[model samples]
Target: MLWLVPLFLLALRAVQAWSPTDSYAPGNVSCADDISLVREASGLSPNETAWLEKRDAYTKQALREFLDGATANFSNSSLVDSLWSADKIPRVAMAFSGGGYRAMLSGAGMISAFDNRTNGSTEHGLGGLLQGATYLAGLSGGNWLVGSLAWNNWTSVQHVIDTRGKDDELWDISNSIVNPGGINILSSASRWDQISDAVEAKQDAGFNTSLADVWGRALAYNFFPTLSKGGDGYTWSTLRDADVFKNGEMPFPISVADGRYPGTQIVDLNSTLFEFNPFEMGSWDPSLNAFTDVKYLGTNARNGTPVTKGQCVAGFDNTGFVIGTSSTLFNQFLLQLNTTSVSSFLKGIIGDFLKDLSEDYDDIAIYNPNPFRETEFVESNYTKGIVNSENLFLVDGGEDGENIPFVPLIQKERDVDVIFALDNSADTDEYWPAGLSLISTYERQFGAQGKDIAFPYVPDFDTFINEGLNQKPVFFGCDASNTTGLSYTPPLIVYMPNNRQSYNSNTSTFKMSYSSSQRMKMFQNGFEAVTRNNLTDDSSFRGCVACAVLRRKQESQNMTLPQECAKCFQDYCWNGKISNKTAKVSTIENYSGSISFITDSASADAASSTAAASSSGTSTSKKNAAASLPSSNSLKWYVAFASLLGMAIGLM
Candidate 1:
């Protein structure tokens, strides 16, 4: 009887006819009734119906903005304040070339002007004012228009060059934005001084200077100093401790095998610079004589090997070091060390000036002169960039004669709305957990703020238990479908607050009979379901299934919608699964594909015992490895994920 109530309400709406004026009447036709009918008609969940609605609203809003000529704007003062409040910080921008020079001047001038206008009470710098302007431009289309015009005018006058020359230096100059050598020499020098000073200061403060210290400081200082000091001090340790070793004596060199050269070069850890014995085969050989091999005297001499030494030859300007019988290792090590030190110094100086604008402005806003929070602005812009970058853009294949860059015309932001119609068939119960996990992980990584509601399938058993018995049921739909023979037919509908839905169907294609708004509601509902569902358990396959279904639906709809709609949908649904089997297989693969082993070890009692054992083992291992070299596992997993996702999406 409880299950039939929604069904009955839907039935009434389906049969009843109303005039245009009466269509808006809440009592006459409500989302509750509409969703109930959808559940009865399509066998999806009420949550899914709600998802579809929210999706539709977003799609519509996007279309409207596009059609009405509006631009998206983002702001947050908290993030900006936080960034500014940091003790050590990187420089945001480096003045390079004519355009960069002009921009810097403009930024500084604008800040000064703003300060004067505000009675010189603001603590913000020139970069902050520019950031504010950029933020405003991002929010308003008018600013973009003006900016474009200004850019064009500036480029026209400053970058004019003949395109016919084989050695067109103009292109070379223009490309200097991304090129290292083309940067302005004066600016580079200034940045280097700034970085060197900062590093020296840190060293004086007795901070734990390491490779990370150097790199992180470089990033914060946004400067690269010249390497006036000799030796190959470009190694991570040296760079990190650049401040510490400012006036310190160079360490003795050690002999390094040829095979380890690549690793040494990559991490700047060449033994030629900091090894204890430059000519010795290993780290140190105390028995080695400074001039010649000493006469045998004690047992320590017998055990100790002679340290290799180099002497001046007849025609050579300086004496060359020799290791064992070969001078090759000794000579090469010295050369590498000398080159690396100078190179790193130059790199540090240059890198500081070219710092990204966002980093600089983020720090500035942290001190509280803005209306919005700093974190909000950073998150919004970062997410927006991610979304924009993920969108599809067309390119010429080069094989064809057609060599034009023409993007697909997507629907305007205001015109089209998206609805996520999910398939919540019995098969979904197996793979929904993966989808849930993905949502949870993404939310944790990116910060959850604008996500829509999710629609899930509500079975008759839960409805009956909750409504008929007036008691909450532990198992919502455990008895509704027989797990042994799960079927794809008769999809259930659940309404969520947002317009998103997840559908699980056996067929490759399924009919969606809901209106545009209803479709969005379905997607939102599915999104919510996946978001709320616990993914710690192995059975959380529901989320993955929903994600796949929603992706497919979005893709299909993208084909018929405007370019922006397609782009947005494609970006969100990128790497989405097309089949239930694929979703299930992916989830299983993630768990190592051996369900039996995982399940056996994952049992409640077994898990507790195993956890205790692992903890004990870990403690012992940590103690033993405390003095040894660091392991690669310390790198964050999110960095790896971001890299992989970036590569995949970039290629796509």
Candidate 2:
């Protein structure tokens, strides 16, 4: 008889892909190299800037093709010139937020709408946006989207869907991370040992191991498929070698994390923000603004040379560990590690380890021989940690609520002209982007000690929700003159919040696994939100995207604005307004309702009732209650249980 998986709540794998052929082999991607380089303390790496030069050429060509399709029947030669010109071309970026799998799949859907690779995405869709984009960044679960596509040589989202379930590869979450599902038929007992052994080996080799390492191995089973590709190992740095990434065929991938000091849940605006690309692991944030050779992570170096730990360590920044570092919110599962489901004897063994981990490494990555330890630029707030053990602890990117990886994208050095930030955050009790991410980012950009980055104006959360700005698309920094305080014109931000007209894509971030059908609906809902249901709701959606692209170029060239673009700016730009008072979702026929999309549609009346139920009790108890109150930024347990039971896992 087939085994029926036990019902459990919490603990989720954000991105899923792949498995190998009949038998599992060693690994595919190669790790480590013979080269060494000088680590720079300031500015973009020479390597990345050189790569961006080549990448810009690819995107410009792609954008010219997109513009031809968008403006085929138009008569404006000047507009076409700016759109198609090598110099006047707009630099575009796409950012994904972290909300577990919801962030991953919803992000995938948004990309599908922007990508030419998806069927019908180009015609009357935003498909060409991906090709036009130079940078792709993700936070928490969002990195799952970036990593999955990059690992496959930058394959299309459709391809990820097509290959899944054919042999239980690429999104077979039927087996929880706690259980082995792919080609490895080992029972949960064997798999647990396998994970523990791997981590132990790393520790045995004189490297420090933490819960993040264990979490990485658990999450990698679904997304990291190279274990059987026959090589030393697969890692995030290995992507620099893939032909697609190396040839500049794919947008540069950035993974984000916040440096967290021990014994604190508070992630202040001044906290060190770190980013990981294939070439380096560092931060653009003013505090310790520097990058280290990601390939030489475990090496003991003095100003970038091997010293104390003479032998450099390869595979230290494991691809899975790096991705897991950005999404450790699910490490709450460790609390469930000692549950009775396994065995009393094994439970006792792990329960001991859990106690020790709770003291210091609570769901965070531990980077030893921290590249910034002895560097001159190391700020005092960050110096203490390195002083103790030369360790750097990094946590989930969204810990400070800047769920979209905007730090790197906004770096003036990158010269990004526009950022299409995908906000799939569970900002409300119903799970939608409430513009909190934007608010946090804005405050930090202009806040005390945060003077380096430039950000456009974002209204209070009250204004964001009350004005219906969170329910649809809006643009910030539409005019270059507005950011007069910055050294350079900040990139225009096209904020796209999640909405539900088709699929209820606002699933809780804590709900761990999802079935193929539910996952596909998320992809569809994401596509609808980005296209506004293919102009079925707002006909101006595509035009607005084009206008955001054209805004900067228009200012730079002092070109007469197109009438359509002028209207787009007037409609989407956030006028300087502050409102501490909150608002409701736009009830305009185009938008479904102000209620949580996760709540079923009983009618407008039922939405209010459900919202009430949420505040009176928990979301699980709100099916019969009135409307729910807006929740705090932290993940809600009620949403978690309700989501786990209602979809994916059929607990009932």
Tens digits of lDDT, candidate 2, 366-473: 776666656644554533344234667788888665778898988877778899999998766566788877766665654432557777756655567767788788
**What lDDT, from 0 to 1, does candidate 2 have?**
0.65
Estimate, for each residue in 1-652, the C-alpha lDDT of model 1 and write its tens digit.
2423432343233222211112111111122211111001112233323333443333233322222221111121122222223311111111100011111122122222212122221222111111111001100011111121121111111111122122321112221211112236554344334434433443343221212222222222111111211011121112112221121111111111111111111111111111111111111111111111111100011112211122110100000111111111111212122222234553353234212211121101010011111112123332222112211111101001000000000001111112211112111222211222112111111112112112112222122222221110011111122211222211111111111123321110011022223323332233233222222221222222222222222332332222333333232222211121112122212221011111112232342233223323321100111111222232233122322222222221
Task: Give the lDDT of residue 311 in candidate 2.
Answer: 53
Candidate 1 stretches greater than 4 Å from native: 1-67, 70-197, 220-440, 443-652
CA RMSD per model (angstroms): 31.1, 11.6
Error of 2 at 100 (Å): 0.5
Candidate 2: which stretches are off by over 4 Å? 1-38, 73-77, 83-86, 180-186, 229-232, 308-310, 331-357, 377-389, 583-652
Provide TM-scores for the models.
0.18, 0.79
Poorest stretch of ten by lDDT in candidate 2:
3-12
